[model samples]
Target: MRFTLFISAILLLGCTPKDTIAIERQLILSADFSHYDNFFPIQTLNLIKKGIKDKIHIMYVCFDPGIDGEKEFPGEDYMDDFSFKIMKDGKYQPTFDKSALVIGNDFKEYFKEDFDSYKKLKAEGNISRFIEMPEKPEWWQYDQTPKNSKGKPMTFICQIDMGRIIINDDCRLFVFYDQDDRMVKYVYQRT
Candidate 1:
């Protein structure tokens, strides 16, 4: 009886190969970054996805366009360009830190919580406004754009919208449904 109802629910919700991803999400921020930086200042990463249903948080990051394969950061004195580096093992903490959040945690503790947006908020010693969460991923918006022959989501060549922190003006963060991993993975793309 339960099995029958579950199937019915999926059908009703228009579940397709692309719509429903079967991933058992956890309560922690278990992300896999391609780069490594001990003191990468993760608190400044852009919180791209604010899970309305699963309560998941996805961090957006970038890498050197010159490098190939999974993104990796160089030594401390690299003069960061794209902001795609990771923490030096000791820098990244899996546990949640209230002060690290850019938005969604409500304004509290002043500059700590809004570390990335602090400068933006202050306008010549006057407080403008805070930079809130950018918005959910643009899956639905892209849905309207025709898919390719293989039925994959149409990949726009260049990044159009600029995210608050981690994502730059020409960068875009995409949600890659990793079926084998049984979890959703966020993809930081230049195009």
Candidate 2:
């Protein structure tokens, strides 16, 4: 009877619900482009450029502009989500249709002064030429390794697209490559 009770108690203890802790192992950078000189760093840009050169896939995450305050937009089933794209045969191909992911109005308003230039570039389709140029190291701030929510040290690479004036402050796109250098994750932060 004692042996059976002990075994039963052991089994019960083993079956007890385990405390689960969520740990974020991935590195994340919170970049505020408005103060580009302070947050954007040079080394990170170089790393990202290298990743792009290596043909790593890019993932873009953004909130649905039509949605408001955590409320789902009519006919929308999923929250603002990540969009993955890959370069195949020198062409960028998105995994899903991205007709809904338009630039936010706030960004357009904030960059109103540069709107005409941006429009011209868009019409010319020569935006890549500007981004492909070698970035001046002096233009960026220093690299910063900050602790994430999980207390893990992460490389935080932040950049502001001053030239493009494309995205709003609430919307952020993070670009990084995996160990294989075959995948680039572009995480968009929606306020």
Candidate 3:
């Protein structure tokens, strides 16, 4: 009887579930632009006209915030801190245009407020607004292509629009999204 009781107790303990904790994963950013062949060719010329003379650096960086993996984070709004560079001759040249880069959350939010006007401007192909980029990424507008830890495309949360060139007058304008497509990374120099 004692042996049976001990065996039963061991079985009960073994049957109990073990406590486990969900491991959080770090976000990953990948630079890939092979998907936008059409926009680059034409936009490259426009960039040159704006004084960018070298091959435009196209980077696709996707951040995967592991906890809520299903959310889609747009890279255009995720640029908190970044470095801009230009390729001069045969080398990568760091740019001093850092001061020129501005974060425009208010402008974006304001623009978003007028959905009808925004749509109209977008339809007219004049949606580019020269404003500061958002200081922090807007998680609420998490609309982008989802990627796995390995940097592989998993699923798309929302349809990406074409890249838009927000002209900074004669100085420079960074292309956030073209048509309906978002770029992971973009770098150029102001001439």
Candidate 4:
């Protein structure tokens, strides 16, 4: 299983867009899953990036790793929900035809100011990105990953939490990816 997973990872990396590979290579993830939490950790973000970007489609994952009644073990990497919606006519509207509500951006304009891009991170005069590994120790690869939009390849980029009051608690991660920037800007919500 590990070998299959590793080969899949290699192929996935080989398939990613060149530009998405050059994004925020360095980031600090702080999850509320811990106690006495004061955002103070410099762990690398590439592990999560490589795992999801390579294996899964360049899209968003509304994931919460510690949701109750699901995982048999705490801190186990589990993604059972990928719900997504849009704000149309000043009210939340569903844009999905299925359970996986994938929201994708064009090849360019990933860092644009509009909410169409998850870079809507700059609120309250600040920008924040969060990612944290479960006590599971590693995120090798995802099973049953999603497919890209418009039958085009995409690259996973960054993550955003719409409900950011506290991370890894009740917040569903907003993972984004793209097919522009030479590839797609993909984000997988791994909270």
Model 2: pairs clashing at backbone N, Cα or C within 3 Å: none
* Model 3 Cα lDDT, one tens digit per residue, 3-118: 56534533432221121111111111112222311111111111333232332332212211222222222333223212223322312222222222222444444233333333
lDDT accuracy of residue 17 in candidate 1: 24
Overall local distance difference test of candidate 2: 0.32
lDDT score for candidate 4 against the true structure: 0.29
TM-score of each: 0.29, 0.33, 0.20, 0.25
Instruction: Report lDDT per candidate.
Output: 0.28, 0.32, 0.26, 0.29
Error of 2 at 61 (Å): 8.9
How do the candidates rank by lDDT, highest first? 2, 4, 1, 3
lDDT of 4 by residue, 96-146 (tens): 222221223441232122232233342332333233212221322342233
Tell me how candidate 1 scores on lDDT: 0.28
Give the Å shift of residue 35 in candidate 3. Answer: 16
RMSD of each: 14.7, 21.0, 23.1, 15.6
Total colliding residue pairs, candidate 3: 21
Q: Output the number of the TM-score-best candidate.
A: 2
Worst 10 residues of 2 by lDDT: 16-25
Which has the higher TM-score value, candidate number 1 or candidate number 3?
1
Model 3's alpha-carbon lDDT is: 0.26
When summed lDDT is taken over every stretch of 10 residues in candidate 1, the lowest stretch is 38-47
